[model samples]
Target: MTAKEPSVFRQGFKDGLPIGIGYFSVAFSFGIAAVSSGISWWQAVLISFTNLTSSGQFAGIGLIASFASYIEMALTEFVINMRYTLMGISLSQKLSPAFKMPFKLTLGHCNTDEIFAVAMSRQGEVSPAYMGGLSILPYVGWTGGTLAGAVLGNILPFSLSQALGIMIYGMFMAIIIPAARRERPVLFVVLTSVIISCIIYFVPAFSFITSGFSIIICAVAASALAAWLHPVEGEVADET
Candidate 1:
């Protein structure tokens, strides 16, 4: 909170504020979804706080509601959230030399998509103070929004809750639609994934595999195909 300490921290907080505000709606949907999936309100809040992931947490809730075994849940989470590991590795190269392992470890826990993007967009090496400031607000917003939605879920009618459920997909579309419009490979990958997922869902033969495994299969297949078809150039990778 001390402005005299460093301008980078303040700048990071300022930049992160918008992402925090945006997180409210998404996390709100997640909260509603989690509660509807049979977890208690406090449990929903706890999941949001601890997991700090949108799609992964939603997928986990689905698995939990379906009574998936622990191994299945773990594997699904690992598959779905494996991108964070890549993000962390990419981010490590951008950190300031003064940023030690402890700082990296601390910041790693809160490095969600928005935070990573903002940090990577910076011109110079990322400072621990800035990352700290950047992460705090969004963390609060995501967790707070989940808490609010969980409380509201108890009072909201079934019809209204169902309507609110679409917000999660809407948020996803808002993210992918822009990039997919610009990038043919992204669009192709998305379509491929959707087709694969549909085939898995509708085909009786794939009925033995759970939805969780189906998603993993679709994602892996689509990503591998996309990588093969459109290997990213260094410049393109930087842009991405």
Candidate 2:
């Protein structure tokens, strides 16, 4: 008899394991940062649970700590997370017939960067079951790690908690450095964003710009510059 093939859900779960593990470490740092920023441990965990995007959450907590306005927070989050909208559009093409509107709405919450990459890399149409399985572990790991870190932040010495908070920066660098090395466009965009951010933060002329607006400006300006400099070679497909 032939060996049985793994179920699609099982396959997705297996593929998501590494991503889940990675999320735990990064989310731990986020948890520490959140608590250190003056939020309660439960609040930190709640942020992680509700907003799965790492960068957005980090920026958001900073804004929260600085007592930014609701509009600033909303705009900043919308700008940072706009990529997910694009990712959702791309994945729409690959959804199986069984992946209906309700499933799409539910799973869209879990359509994170890593998850999007994994889903896009798969062969043929992706099923709802597979997406469900892929999301479970990462969600748990992120939330669980935040809970662990937030609680530990209360118990650990202040210096140590501050040190642990730096891990998230390292994680972002690790992610960006490799891709930036491989692609000139990536490098250019990264450098441009960094420069713009520095200018906004350090230049007295731009001192009036709040942290939240500064982030929005950097992201939009860098991305717009990159697109102008290196436009992708594709025609806009018309939706009939």
Candidate 3:
């Protein structure tokens, strides 16, 4: 690659490298979990590449392993990860208006939170191709770590494995930490989730709804409350 290309690529890599380091442990947990659930290493890796989402990947693996129907799988994942649709729209404005379908088809698969945050932070045009490279490396790394973890997990004791699994929750908590600091509504939503999760855990009758459904319900409810409490800025209607 050209020196200029490397310079152009450095920003996305810098943005994603920390995520890559974090994914080593977290994705390793996913890999081991996938293996423990009887999925193969290659399958786990493929899912990581295609899904590029932690919650959605876990849900898909659970449903796939459980022999969930296509409709069930689709609906569960769609509800859980519908945030990507909104995120995509927001990210699209960063791209040139001429961003074509082929580029979208190739790189759209890797539009995760880290990529979006990094891409949006840049002041000028972030070459989509360079961003794709930055995104792809971590994707492979996350999947690779998982595959390695799955293979190693087969030999490790259950206690050690569970301890290692805490990394995934820790990574999520890291995401929540920054958001909570920046946005009051985010903190409120998190608190709301905590309350709802307690209710879900304690209330026995509602157990029929899966984690996927719970996520959908909570997001919808939290969004409604956030909107009601904090209406869009400057949205007062002007009367003629």
The parts of candidate 2 lying over 4 Å away from their true place are 1-6, 154-240
User: Each prediction's Cα RMSD?
Assistant: 4.6, 5.3, 5.2
Candidate 2, residue 91: lDDT: 87
| Per-residue alpha-carbon lDDT of candidate 2 for residues 15-62, written as tens digits (9 for 90 to 100) | 778778778877888888899999999999999999998889999999
Models 1 onward score TM values of 0.69, 0.68, 0.73
- Which scores greater on lDDT, model 1 or model 2? 2
Which pairs clash in the backbone of model 3? none
Higher lDDT: candidate 2 or 3?
A: 2
Taken over the whole model, the C-alpha lDDT of each candidate is: 0.80, 0.81, 0.72
What lDDT score goes with residue 143 in model 2? 96
Error of 3 at 102 (Å): 2.7
Q: Report model 3's TM-score to 2 decimal places.
A: 0.73
Estimate candidate 2's alpha-carbon lDDT, on a 0 to 1 scale: 0.81
**Total clashing pairs for each candidate:** 0, 0, 0
For 1-240, candidate 1 gives per-residue lDDT tens digits of: 345438877888887786677677678878888888899999999998898888789888998999999998888888767767767877887877668989877878888877887787677677788898898888888899899888875576777656755654664575667778989998999999999999999999888876656766887799889999999786644532
